[model samples]
Target chain A: DTAVSQTPKYLVTQMGNDKSIKCEQNLGHDTMYWYKQDSKKFLKIMFSYNNKELIINETVPNRFSPKSPDKAHLNLHINSLELGDSAVYFCASSQGSGRVYEQFFGPGTRLTVL
Target chain B: QQQVKQSPQSLIVQKGGISIINCAYENTAFDYFPWYQQFPGKGPALLIAIRPDVSEKKEGRFTISFNKSAKQFSLHIMDSQPGDSATYFCAASYLEDDYKLSFGAGTTVTVRA
Candidate 1:
């Protein structure tokens, strides 16, 4: 079985549009995270949720929000997206929120805003 | 600020040669360091990792050499093959938190046969 999965492998949209990317993990992990990779291939942490609590919120814009309905799902919602929002988003999960830092990542969601 | 710095943003090595990527971190609190491998259209996967306690770690063809005093670490791939070509990322985390990972920019390695 797939450990982690994300929907909408590719998305192309225009500026000012709203979009959502869904992520799910079946690893029975307690912590989930979202990362963004820009055109330069620099990966940065965007958000993290552990046991349904928002833990890490990076220096992202207000246009981006992450919602975790439960421990198993974390979804990203972008409102009024801009051209700079074009990038790849990855979802990851780990067994715990403390020592075990090895994360299992899902196939990324490539979002392009023109 | 970028807590972790990686060198050689891109690399090309002949098949069966050794490929090396280096990384440095400013945070002394970082205890765990991991290397991630990513291919096109896919998320990065954990290739190997090391802790400050060990100076060297070897697994199969991959090796990690760490210098705690220098706060630097490097990944060495022996007998590199074309199939091993991919982007490699180095990340660091503190002993206290699991919510965040400070990542290096990334290095793209191309092994030519």
Candidate 2:
């Protein structure tokens, strides 16, 4: 069974287009996160939601919006995509926030903006 | 914008040998340090983690060495196998914003059989 999963495994779109990626978790996790991995393999957190409430919102652009319909799902929507937005977007879930919790990652959605 | 810095962008080790990857951070506020392993086309998986209060933590063949004074931490994979070949990322998170992980640039590890 898949603990965490993301849709649109690979997305190729032109600049100025809008797209959305969906994520879900079956691990009964309370916290979900969105991270971006750049071409240099540097992973950074973009946003986090806990129990359908927004928590951690990093220095990400306003064009990126994260929505959590429930504790089981977190969806990311990007507006007016740019060439720099071409990277792998990962969805992760954890039981909670703390040192005791281990985050589980889903197979990333590779978004390529041309 | 990256807080944690990892070294040896890539390394090749032989089977039965040890694979070491090191990371350093300037922010001492980072209390929790964790190591993750990611294979191509797959999301990263947590291998092990350590807190600054301790010097080292080991699990199975993976060991995390933490040097709080020097602001450095390293991951050692003992008895390295070809299956261990993948990209390794060292991440740090603080208590206040514990859920947000600041990951370092990943290191590619290739273990030869």
Candidate 3:
């Protein structure tokens, strides 16, 4: 069984279009995260949620928003996407936040903004 | 100052040789260090980890050497095969929070047969 899974593995959209990526984890973890990996392969954390409570919000733009309906799912939504939004989006989960931080990452969703 | 720094953005090693990746951190609060291996088109998986109290930890062909005073650590892969080629990431975290790990820029290792 896949521990962490993300949907819309590949997405191609034009600028100004909005998109959403769904993520789910079966690891029985309580914390979920959203990260963006640029073309240079630099992974940066965007948002983190613990038990559906928003915890960490990095210096990301307001265009990107993360929503966690429960402990097992965290979804990413982008509003009025731009060309700079082209990159792979990853979903991750962990048992807790902060110091208990061993995260399980998903396969990643590749987004190409034209 | 929770930054984890990794060196040698890329490495090329011959099969049967040893591949090493190094990392450094500035956070003294960090107590756990873990190495993750990622293959093409796949998410990273845990490879090996070490705590500050231990100087070294070895599991199978993978070993982690840690220096508590220097706040440095490394991942050494012995008898590396082509199949072992992948992007390796080094991460550090404190036990105080729920274990939020801070990762360094990945090191891509290529083992040629």
Q: Where does candidate 2 chain A have its weakest 10-residue lDDT segment?
A: A94-103
Off by over 4 Å in 1: none
**Reference-based TM-score, model 1:** 0.97
Predicted candidate 1 versus true structure: per-residue lDDT over B1-113, tens digit per residue: 99999998999999999999999988898998999999988899999999899999999999999999999999999999999999999999985766268889999999999
**What TM-score does prediction 3 earn?**
0.94
RMSD of every prediction: 1.0, 1.2, 1.6
Better of 2 and 3 by DockQ: 2
Q: Please, what are the lDDT tens digits per residue for candidate 2 over residues B24-54?
A: 9998888889899999999999999998889
**Lowest lDDT 10-residue stretch of candidate 1 chain B:** B94-103
Model 3's alpha-carbon lDDT is: 0.89
After superposing candidate 3 on the true structure, give the runs of residues whose Cα lies further than 4 Å from its correct spot. A98-101, B96-98
Which candidate leads in TM-score?
1
Per-residue lDDT of B1-113 in model 3, one digit per residue for the tens?
43999988999999999999999988898888999898989877888888888999999999999998888999999999999999999988776644666888999999999
Which pairs clash inside model 1? none
Model 2, stretches more than 4 Å misplaced? none
Candidate 1 A-chain TM-score: 0.97
Model 2 TM-score, all chains together: 0.96
* DockQ list for all candidates: 0.77, 0.77, 0.60
